[model samples]
Target: MSDSSFLNWPFFEERHRVLAAALEGWCASHLPVDHSDVDAACKGLVAALGAAGFLQPSGAGAGEKLDVRSLCLIRETLARHDALADFSFAMQGLGMGAVSLFGTEEQRLWLEKTRAGKAIAAFALTEPGSGSDVANTATLAEKVEGGYRLSGEKTYISNGGIADVYVIFARTGEAPGARGLSAFLMPADVAGLTIAERIEVIAPHPLARLKLEGVFLPESALIGKAGEGFKLAMSVLDVFRSTVGAAALGMARRALDEALARVQARKIQGEPLANLQMVQGHLADMALKVDAAALLVYRAAWTKDQGAARVSREAAMAKLYATEAAQEVIDAALQLHGGDGVRHGMKVEELYRDIRALRIYEGASDVQRVVIARTILGEAR
Candidate 1:
């Protein structure tokens, strides 16, 4: 809706530009500004995004092929308009991405159902003891006569309480680490699976902790090979992380727009704030950071689209830079807004909260720094 500059980059095609325009128009009309019920709002956004066909780009096609660039573009646009809308669209793809990437035909079929908005999907990997240290997962899935019995708890799960289906990870081997892990598709209606608690954060979406007590999933539920769950999860993150950056980019762009509008119209010292040299300097700095973030995010997305199997370095760089820079940009926008920035119902106020979580989720800023350093050092070897 803002502009098509990013779509014109070499990373996108004509279709991507068209999608950007269409989604922008759709979001302008569809996104609900009223924040009455967050859950209902999310559900409505999901159904609207699905109907508008924007959610389609989040996953692989019918043939197991995904367009990462399109995914990033969609996130960037949706995020600019509404962070919740972006989240709704993203979770659909991320929660079901494993199935799209590594699932058998049956899994793909299930994913198709979820992708079409008929069912909500979730990804359950985090546990109480394991946030960044995924290998330290204590959740266990023991092989049984007919299937696997999953016994573990996943905390901080997005869409945890609301999802109809989940891609759950659990340890299956005696080996002390990630080697023994496996991923399974567990439906919410399955016996022994429960939403333990709904976790609230600064920016509220549908988040919860899950308790799995002897959850029996048939062998058909396993995604990819046993011991490949870690790889599968990492791979999925590789694709989605950059999109996370794109989401941040969208928020930053919105912040910049808000700042520009405020500066241009608000009067100060007998003239408009835009007439102040200091204000111009702040705007310049904000614009620089935004462009830098865009470059990193689009570069990562483009590299992945070019068929790079693992984009750990690029993705980390993108996520790290874009999220961090967006924070600074948003803060500047808030500064520009003065008292109005923190007003209860102001857009920048909401964005301040929305942007805060991006720095922590998907991967935290510190975790991304470590990831980028590791990749750089590993390449030198």
Candidate 2:
């Protein structure tokens, strides 16, 4: 219900507009309500989206390639309707991002099943002791008789307990820092792999701690080359980070929509709340932030789709600006709602919780700032 004029920006094409409108209608019919059991709900959502032919953009086929703009459009629209739905859709793309970008024919087969909703996928790079510092990952993968033995833990993994396949990263050598790591594709039922614990957050989603416990993976489990794990992980994040920003923009737009409806319907003293200067000021700020965030989000998505080998700098800026702005916009929305904003089950209340995680995930806002600075200063290139 927010403005659609932005879809006409140079960053988008006629197809993107068509995609947004179609997905918007589909979400209106399919994803209006919230879910209680995050795990089961996400699984159901994955199946539903795949049945609807919406998850194919997450993976590429023999003659097909991923279009990042479509990924952003679907995420933005789905998020506008429901964040859990967005999460369900986002994970499908993000979990399969490496495979979609670098997987061989056999790996692509798994991605095809994931796109069809036959299987669930997870990206497991963050460990109990290593997060932003990928160089320090403790999960070790050792060369063995037939394959590799993986032993360690990965925490804060989305789709952790329920995923059918995981794109896991582990240290395969002694090279210093991020050089020795490698990527693997391990099935959920693999021997010695266990979901050690489930994590409950303020905004509920399926998250878990995985204990590999010396699980042995076949040589086929490898995704890219050995010692390319760090590079692959960063590459995947580079592509999906802009989509994360798009998702935040959707939530912010929803918050603005909710706030607008509230203010117009709400009265203060003797006149409508919209008549008050203070309320109008809040609405103006929220609207401004939403537009600004949308620009950055689409710009990054556009840049990626334009054949840039990497959009790390653009993605970092988009994610940083959009997520931080979303927090502010949702906060203004809550303030506009007054006491009702904090009231349980209120839309603004839900948005307030949902927007917080955006700032923290994919890469924290602070980390994004560091990335931006390094790129600008020529420290990273």
Candidate 3:
């Protein structure tokens, strides 16, 4: 299913290849075939991923910088194996990404526990009103004696109800639009906070909406500075966005694999489905998309690892193309599966659901296009 030849490309190191192979073997033997108890399954997956040392790539330990190529490889492998597994791993990296990139000594203490799977983590930036328009943040954080009193709500937060700590964004009145926002490391059990709703999605892994009436936090909770949240958020997003594309590329590869198997194994009108020219065309197209997407995803990741200041444009292009390409690839695979594709418990059915969300989360496709165009046109978003 995987195009292993891509691993031989200059974008990856020998260490990354070793890590990918090790994690793939671990996932094959350990990851559950069914996540009937989605919550428990997620917890278990996190613990397993951590214990196997795969989670170490998250760079949660002190003084360790994340290797984007390693992150991309793990994501691609995990997504190919289990969607929930990939989500669990991704949320951990994202929830702690801010701290990993910019947190002070005390602020990053929890990374040990988070990376060890002893503590759950969440990144709470999206609101009911603003998803991609991060500048329009509505969640208010008012200055108080000891710290800030946070009020307002955050919706569609990954690992929301379950997270031990959240990297939260809120408006602080220091400025307007994006500058007014601040990032905080808030504990889930803050006195004035509540998990207002536990959302159920087509593919779910602990999504929730939260309300903070007057949550109080110490001044030490801030990540970077008050007016620096927007910048911090963008930096964190830049690192993870390309990995999202890698995950999509993985799913697309799996879909192509499934399509190839189905076409060759199934018979139609006294002949193999693989024998049909039309089926061959679909297979060829699927293969092309998967490969092309891989090139973009790894290119962005490799560029970042090479110490470029920011790979924003490359990241956006990778995410936009890979996610959209994965959707098409998965749909084509589902089409090849015919009746069995939509049937419950089918792998292709699950892949169809799994691939849809990549386009929407971590900056939607439309938003990515705007970002790419802005970068090319010498403008800012």
TM-score (all chains, Cα) for each model: 0.98, 0.98, 0.98
Please identify model 2 stretches exceeding 4 Å from their true place. Answer: 379-381
Ranking by lDDT: 3, 2, 1
TM-score, cand. 2 vs. native: 0.98
Q: What is the TM-score of candidate 1?
A: 0.98
State the RMSD for candidate 3: 1.5
lDDT of 2 by residue, 109-193 (tens): 8998999988999999998788888899989999998899999999999999999999999999848779999999888999899
- Native-referenced Cα lDDT, model 1: 0.87
lDDT of 1 by residue, 163-249 (tens): 888999999894668887889998899999988999988888999999999999999999999988888899999989999999999
For 1-381, candidate 3 gives per-residue lDDT tens digits of 466888899888899889988987898897644688888888888888888778777754566778999999999999998988999899889999999988889987878778887788899999999999999999999999989999999999998888899999999978879988999999888899899999999876799999999999999999888988999999999999999999999899989888888999999998999999999999999989998999999999999888888999999999999999999999999999999999988889999988888999999999999999989889642
